[model samples]
Target: MTGPARSHTEAVAAVGRALAAYETQAGVAADAALVAARRIATDAAAAQADRQRHLERAEADLRACRAEPEARCTAEQARVVQEQHGLEVARRAVSMAERAVRDLAASRVRFRSEAAALITPGRTMTSVKGAELEAYLSSVGLRAVASAGPGSSSAGPVSAQRPSGGGGRDIGGLPEGFELVALDLVDVPDPVTGRDQFGKGYSPEDMAWAFSAFDDVVLPALRAGEGSEYFASLDAAEGRMGTRSYSDTYSGFLGSDAIVLEARPGGRYELSENGRHRFWVAQQTGRPTVPALVRR
Candidate 1:
């Protein structure tokens, strides 16, 4: 309660206020430093996370690249399979076409042969299975002309005639007594010399080449003829010429009988000795039967 006492109290209170202010300032400085440190730590953690994500993405890309080659290989294989299927389809088409040509050719031979057989001098008018043969010939692109025969007409113009039914189908059905002989690739003989000027002997290699030609060219040619708009009006159907097995050792018939030119499997060539000779004779006379030539 004295003046001196009051001044001392004021001084003490002032000293306390100064100490509190110092403590507050120290606390604000410490909080600011902690906030700065926290911000730095957050930024560092975000950077680390981003780097990890980038690394993961890079690894994923590397894996994808590694798998790409195999994927491409698989795609190539699929393309090859598709191409093989297309080739098989084309091969089957060719085979069917050949069959049509063979059938038509055979019918012509038979009619001519029968005509010759009926006559002593091998010259006479021959008739075939009337409606059936006519239809077949028509389908195969040959129209019957009662007015003439082979020597009687060239590929020249004749009187107006009805179109024949020569359209043929794939020969999946094997006819009785006929066998699918070896597919023969007939060679175009050297115009001057009637020999196989391309290869040596009638070995397997030669046969292979011949058959390949038949499959690739001759067969296709026959098919084209069968399907041609002009040729389709003939009556024709393909049948087995012959089939020869590799087991048969005697290559005796090669270059001999036209029928025995090639053999297929299942004893397609040489139905009988007499039949073979007859077939040979038929071929020589120009009444050639493709199937008969096969000799099975």
Candidate 2:
């Protein structure tokens, strides 16, 4: 035990640090392999060209010897045959080098496909919230207890969840691109702590209104596809919301409250791991379709 009671985010961040380092090293390795393959190809072509020149010179010498005395012609012909053999060997070497380049290129593509699943944020199987986050931590050989104040215990397994209707994964769902759906279509998660923000004194309806207003403040930059700007706006909104007045009214909700929805292998809209209040607002307020990140 390194120690007890490490915060869940701290545990996840450790893995994230390792993942980032791996991504950097992988990028360097991929680039170097490609460069080496190209170099081999270039060198082989040069060698083949040199061999072709030698063969041509040998043929010329053989012709000259044929015009000389018959005795000398035999030796010249034998030397010309050796030059022809050297050219064949050089041609084979070039072919082999070309083959190596192709094999390495294919390997790189496969490596990227696999690493994308692990390293890319959206492509990762678990969002950093709710049951999925816990599941992910367990998969990587770490277990985290939700740091729920004094009597914290293991954040035991919550049911596996899916967006839309649910089936085994089908990557072919959104073959083209994202599908925009009315917020009414979104489904909020069943409460992990027995109830979501609705239980914290305010009525569910009022809490939803709060969430919707917060999202309205956060949505413009998000819709514009400005990642840094969106996150900055999100943080700003979180700060404003976390103040005593806002927090008291909004069930103590705070940072990173951007509504991340997913459309996984099925054309449906649902609240992502942390987006509970907003989904309720969507259902209650009849807000029109909003843009989503649409990760798998």
TM-score top scorer: 2
Clash numbers, per candidate: 45, 0
What would the TM-score be for candidate 2 when compared with the true structure? Answer: 0.43
Question: Which run of 10 residues does model 2 get worst, by summed lDDT?
Answer: 149-158
Predicted candidate 2 versus true structure: per-residue lDDT over 83-189, tens digit per residue: 89988999999999999998887676556434533454421212234335555656677665553211012211111223234321222111223333455556556
Tens-place lDDT digits, model 1, residues 1-296: 23443343333334433433443354455446555555555555555555555555555555565678645454445544555555555555555555545554455444432322233111101111222333444576654443222211111111111212211112211122322232122221222132233334243343443333322222222322322221121212222112222111111222233233333353333233212332333233343123223332
TM-score against truth, every candidate? 0.20, 0.43
lDDT, model 2, position 261 = 62
Alpha-carbon lDDT of model 1: 0.33
lDDT of model 2 at residue 26? 83
